[model samples]
Target: MQKQSKKGFTLVEIMIVVVIIGLLAAMAIPAFQKVRAASQKSAITNNLRQLASAADQYFLEYGIETITSAKLADADVGYLKAFKAVATESYPTDIESGTDIEATDVPTAVSADNTLTIDF
Candidate 1:
């Protein structure tokens, strides 16, 4: 009689592998999500800085201290145009609201009481 060799993984071995993979994936997923959220928050901060700079330039040129959504809609300024474009149809209504920007308080770019804060 010829002896047979085992060519396939046993059921217990397969189950162990599946469980290990599941645990690794569960551990990695939450870390990835946290990193992604931080990156998004950083992007929002950079976007706000750009918008604030543009708004400052606009104010200097037009003698206005604020840039409303309506004004941004009407103007052809590069920063406003970029903000609208980057925001993708939902322009930020409050610069300091922390609704989308992900920050707790208004960024240093704008005043604390300012409502139309440049959000993400």
Candidate 2:
């Protein structure tokens, strides 16, 4: 009688494949988290830039030193739409030292150089 080759993978072969997949997943998860964090940081940066730009415009229009979050979000001026509906609260702080930028986290106001600075 002639011997026929087996068509299916052996137990060891299947285990090796599973281990490879597991290794790939383990490596991928952290990388994905990093990308997500980077994306969040970018969004926070954009938002801060928008806020600072609005503050600058408000200062130019009203000639005020300290511009709160309220006047910027005012519909008549429409300098910024960042803070609305949450009403009568303060502007969030901006910091760049976290895995994600929470709603409460935002950078300080425009600096003396007229640029937003991210606190680390």
Which candidate achieves the best lDDT against the true structure? 2
Instruction: Write the residue-wise lDDT of candidate 2 on 1-120 in tens digits.
Output: 999987999999999999999999999998996676555446656665567777667667777666555666768879888543121123444322221322342222212232334431
TM-score of 2: 0.60
Q: Tell me the RMSD of model 1 versus the true structure.
A: 7.3
lDDT of 1 by residue, 2-117 (tens): 99997999999999999999999999998996676555445656766665555566667887545554454355555465443222213344332223322334332332432223
Candidate 2 regions exceeding 4 Å error are 1-9, 83-120
Q: How many backbone clashes does candidate 2 have?
A: 4
* lDDT of the candidates, in the order given: 0.53, 0.56
Report the lDDT of model 2 for residue 111: 25
Poorly placed runs, candidate 1 (over 4 Å):
69-75, 80-120
